[model samples]
Target: RALNVILVLQCERRRFLRVGLAVPLLGTVAELREMVAREGHIPPEQVMGGMGGTGKGRDPLRATEVPSAVPQVILAEVSPQGFLRSLGDSEELGAAGEGAPLYAFQPPPARRPGTANPSPLAGNRGLHSLDWLGGQGLPASPGAAQPEAQHPLPSAARSSDCLHRGASSRVLLLLCNTVSDGHRLTRFGPPLVLREERGISWEQLQQSILGQLRALLRAEARAQGMGVPLFRIRLAEGMEPCTYLSPQDPHPLCHPAIDRALQLSGSGGPPHVRLMAEWDLNTKERLFGSVQGEAVEDAESVGLQQQAHRQQPSCTLDECFQLYTKEEQVRGTAG
Candidate 1:
């Protein structure tokens, strides 16, 4: 019976291990001995009693039947604290150890706001201003048609001496503005206008502008120099709404004029230039709605009061002369 109990407990321990559960050690041994004594194979008192038997010389069979000593097995020597410490050390060593350079293993540091790397164009400052004389043509004017002429516009010229200059030295000026109609203000993209006071021919200006534009757009580094002053105006809003100009989809403020200018310049040929201006009318209110009729009436009353003050007459030159003559006579007698 005792053997049967030991076998049952061993089976339970094996089953626990298989199912990933912890096994109890000393309790299992005690239960096995109790079962053996209950079966009448051995006396319960002898098994239950402490390891030493009664002083009287008991029968050898009874003594041998119940084992005097249980062997001890060392399952594991590690404490919970020691095991945790070992695991932590291994992880720390992997992170900052000599196996890999710390800088190489770590992620790069973030850049500060507005501290981005400088542009390549920083070196090409003077190239922006070099003038190239290309052609003689009619001066640009607003709302005028181009006159028919036989000679084609001249191409830009280049010199061997000025190849190393940067864009800053060449850039004349940059201007930016927004277009709005009282109610709504809309942004417009930058329009770059480059000018050269002297030295470069018209052909050179065209070539330089084209070359610079290609660089700006990140196109091929070199191409035939277009011989004209180039003007690029990008609309703050994209091209779609402005090109269509539908009332259902209102055009962005600056887009209309910018789009028109680009179209005209492409078709009209070289020496392209355009002027942009804003027009305003006091009668037009914000797009949402107009002021009420009563409000307009009140405004008119206030305006009349302002007009009356403006029209009122003042003392004339004759009155001032008479006053001055009386003062002069009194002063002469006193002297």
Candidate 2:
């Protein structure tokens, strides 16, 4: 036993993410997500898209890496206008800003129920009938916030004809007031399950979304007593884009700046994360914002994200980005 020197090294068991504060780590993505949701003061369910996204790579969930003693990754919450105001060109992302990109988080496909690797939401605590987004600032159309009322879901036994999965289980129904046919359509989703995995094919995430939409449609059909068989469902255009903020560091020099973003988005900070995004049409609003460069391209993989069908949406759409794109063209032409 020639043990020359015994070193007393302080080790941390739980990996923590350096967000607004130092959050403890959990096993699965679902658990990690809850922490993020709490920090951002968002509804657990409404914290979709990049709720648990690392956002540095192709898969958001996969980006949730093991936490280190020091917060290795920094989650910087940049406002919509600030998002456009990166370390680049003018207020508008012009030809000089052509290379400037905006990023979004998309979860990878999850594995089937019985697979070798566990699902992304392996520890998903499918809390029964819990409206996780109850207190969040979900607007009730025309400057009204949704009343603090718990609209309990019908139990499985009562919802015999309802295709709404997790209705009896732990799922989050996202209420989307999408812009469809030049009008807003109040559509509630395919409930999202807390614990699910993204398999190699990434179909797992798609299945969750598509399956929920079908269930909701089926319930609506039965409620109306409509006898027409359901075929397919597609998200309408002109909806806003939901983007997640991820850290981009070729090396670790930018870690401090990342931390700063987290601080700014945390308590008493800016509107880093939002639910219903409207376009940032005012060029002046983009002032004082920095350029993010390559980090902007992080959202490029969004197209590769898996979904139910080619026409179906993998994530919810708001109205912010649409407004900017549509109005920017008109403004450019007029000016």
Candidate 3:
């Protein structure tokens, strides 16, 4: 199933360009941002707005008032009551519900000193066919032009978790394998995006990890006649030795140990992908032990395992279990 997304592209001086998109019902906010960037001709790398659009009190009209070295594009949700809410890239689009309106705010091209400001709405040169919506717009800044919009804003405003304020933590997960050659580490897929707002507990995190592993093998299992995947997380923070996660401890995300590690990592950025997840020995024997051994025979012969200590081990998806961390199940409509 798919839904139509009505996106209003907002620029300074009352210029509005509206575009429509047919997106999968299950498409994510990150995917929607990319689609908007592609359709609206936004520079992907320059599209570095925070999770929620510019918060209240910031003037969209003033975005272009100051000279900026680089341009930025921001995506935000407009409520029925005409309030703006920030959207997370990893969130599901359908969470916004039916007939929900979206707005993309981009500043116009930078102007050199002493150049006359061009009228963005004159003759509707930059405005596309508009689905004009009326409500009290953001309070107009002094001397800001008022919009000529006529459509009435929807009466009922629906609440969605997607509009909440929080940043998702992305953690990189790696698998550890020990052979006669020694320790070999490899990353399977993209970094896991933790969306829990209240802080994640150890048990919840473990289930999420195992669930992702099962999803990766489910397709192959059905075709090749295999069993469910099995593995346990053995977490090790940045540059530290590995240790198994225990059920005894809860609220791992809030642990002081993790906080100290994040402080001392010295990267001053998102923590490194140092968390290790060990595959159960019995699982290797039952699932892909022989297949991996055969697939990497040449690498083994060439001492690749020794090199894997420094880099990712060479292997194919078919030769190893892959993990894909995805969003939680969402049920709603998008329009």
**Highest lDDT scorer:** 3
**Model-by-model lDDT, in order?**
0.25, 0.23, 0.37
**Per-residue C-alpha lDDT of model 3 across residues 4-120, encoded as one tens digit per residue:** 333333332233355555566787766666666676666533233333235323465554222221223445443322212345556677874343455554422333246543332
**Candidate 2 to truth, TM:** 0.19
- Candidate 2 all-Cα RMSD: 25.5
What TM-score fits each model? Answer: 0.16, 0.19, 0.29
> lDDT score of model 1?
0.25
- Which of the two candidates, 2 or 3, achieves a greater TM-score against the reference? 3
* Alpha carbon lDDT at 74, candidate 1: 8
Report the alpha-carbon TM-score of model 3 versus the true structure.
0.29
Q: Model 1, range 213-312, lDDT digits (tens) per residue? A: 2322222223322222222222222233322111111111122333243343321011122322121222112111222111001223234445555675
Give each prediction's root-mean-square deviation over alpha carbons. Answer: 45.5, 25.5, 28.1
Q: Residues 118-148, candidate 2, lDDT per residue (tens digit)?
A: 3223443222121222211111123322212
> Which ranges in model 3 have alpha carbons more than 4 Å from their true place?
1-198, 218-232, 237-243, 264-273, 285-335
Off by over 4 Å in 2: 1-179, 183-187, 190-204, 213-215, 219-335
